[model samples]
Target: MASPHRSDDLHQGDPVEDPPASYEPVNSDDALPYDDYEAEHRPPPTLRLRLAPWDVISTALLLTLLVVLATATNWPWRLYGFLSDVCTGETCGLVPFGVDNYIYPVVWGGIGAAIAAAGVGPFVSLLKGWYMSFWPVLSLTILMVSSVVGDSLTLFSERYWH
Candidate 1:
């Protein structure tokens, strides 16, 4: 003996009511709004690796160290001469009279330029809200670890190669 308003209670043994015709669950995880036509034309997702400031700086530092280490290992006498001169001088004030005098500064300057260049793209990405800081920092850390291994190997080899 149910009133019309109490009809819902009479269906308690039945399955839950279906959604209303006009009801649209716009953002439900079970729903995908894209139709077949749109889905067919959609591009596949891609992963793009973009460099950041710190990544660039770390790369530059690693490159600079590699170059310096290689040169010193190959030409110990020349590196020793340069280090001796720099230590005794007020500053490395020697005229850029030859390759020997200019090479060290040029290498350092090149490293700086490389790092600066790396920063430019990431700065743009940061402005556009597409920047991810973690990857670059992670890459820098990897590069630093690799550089340490490389330097140690280079030193060990130099001992035998000499």
Candidate 2:
């Protein structure tokens, strides 16, 4: 026969068992001695305002490299030139001719701003001791790839379309 009160039964009216005579009860009001000792000895967390000089210097150099690449490849100008060359006369009449003169600068400015914003996160992380050499390298690689892609497109259009 099954017992009336199963071990698993936890009803609220069930009688509570007293603790063993050997068990010592801890008073909630008493604080552990080590708690005070640990609090006194432990160093308080500090906020550091110091900037990492090397990361800043490297980021500056990276920015300089980006500027040099932009100037050398004429990134925005090349893109404008490509668009001007491709969209001419009746073939691309839907878009107003020479509209790129006004639009490209704004478009390229947005792209440049986005790239600069993207670089900021990695630069900050680098300063905060996070390992991030990949960002600068990736930026340079993107510039190189864009330059190559622009040149290739220009060549392809000139050879096949013209």
Candidate 3:
């Protein structure tokens, strides 16, 4: 229904208006009234890499300390384990007993993995599961791989260290 005060200019005595010469799409972000949000009090947004607002840099600076833990002299104690029927569920009587070489390797590998899974790596990812993109599991994988290839490198690198 037309307003009671409608005028002829508006097609029945209403005021005529001109169309806008320029068009600007209304963005949802901008559409929100600035006053509606407590922008002044809102904490700054942070990226997953930031950990706790600039903490990633500090964590990275101290990474040498963590990686150094893998250094041979720094961490000489190897975790060794046995493969008994009770532990591995195998028939052991017929075969000659072997040394328990697994206890240390896998133990260290898991320790490394746990660090990445629950420590700085996770914290660096803003504690989000998406940080798995960093391949946190690689921490343990590298330990296992190092245990194998490190032997080969030691023969060469050890020429000077030993």
Candidate 4:
């Protein structure tokens, strides 16, 4: 014979008490009286733009520095040359690009700014999750691409425009 106090016996055919009629669902998690939510009731917007403002600014500044470097201005080369003298006795290569000029310090300044901005991004709530990883990579890519493009433009201008 089966035991009356068995674990399954207690709930197998037990009657459940109905929820109190006075209780109304106040929160969104509770079942809604309506069939479904519509587009008008969609969730709040997220920050989804591919490039953030800071990334653009940093890339632009770096490209601008490249343009300045291509010029005949001797000050940038002299300054960077003086700074590089302490280390290798040669003018520091500001970027991997072959052109070396006063733009070295300015290029370095823009890179430092990008790094600092990327570092500070995590503290922001929206930037804490996926954005934290995405932003730094994007910033670096933008800077690198801008540098290459600037170099190409410089070469083109010298070859044809002059």
- The local distance difference test score of each candidate is 0.44, 0.52, 0.43, 0.46
For model 2, how does the per-residue alpha-carbon lDDT over 1-162 read when each residue is reduced to its tens digit? 223433443443444355466956488455335456445534465554445667667767776776776678766575445545553445533333343233334445545644764477575664565644445666555544544554554445444344
Models 1 onward score TM values of 0.24, 0.39, 0.27, 0.28
lDDT of 4: 0.46
Ranking by lDDT: 2, 4, 1, 3
lDDT of 3 by residue, 88-134 (tens): 23432222233233434544565666465435565556656333334
Best by TM-score: 2
Tell me the tens digit of each residue's lDDT in model 1 across 91-143. 32333333233334443444354344445535655555454443344434443
* Winner by lDDT between candidate 3 and candidate 1: 1
Candidate 1: C-alpha lDDT: 0.44
Q: How does model 1 score by TM-score?
A: 0.24
Kindly report which residue stretches of model 1 are placed more than 4 angstroms away from their true locations once superposed: 1-118, 135-139
Superposed on all Cα atoms, model 1 deviates from the true structure by an RMSD in Å of 17.8
Q: How far does residue 117 in candidate 4 sit from its true spot (Å)?
A: 3.8
Measured with C-alpha atoms, the lDDT of residue 23 in candidate 4 is 75
How far residue 101's Cα lies from its native spot in candidate 4, in Å, is 13
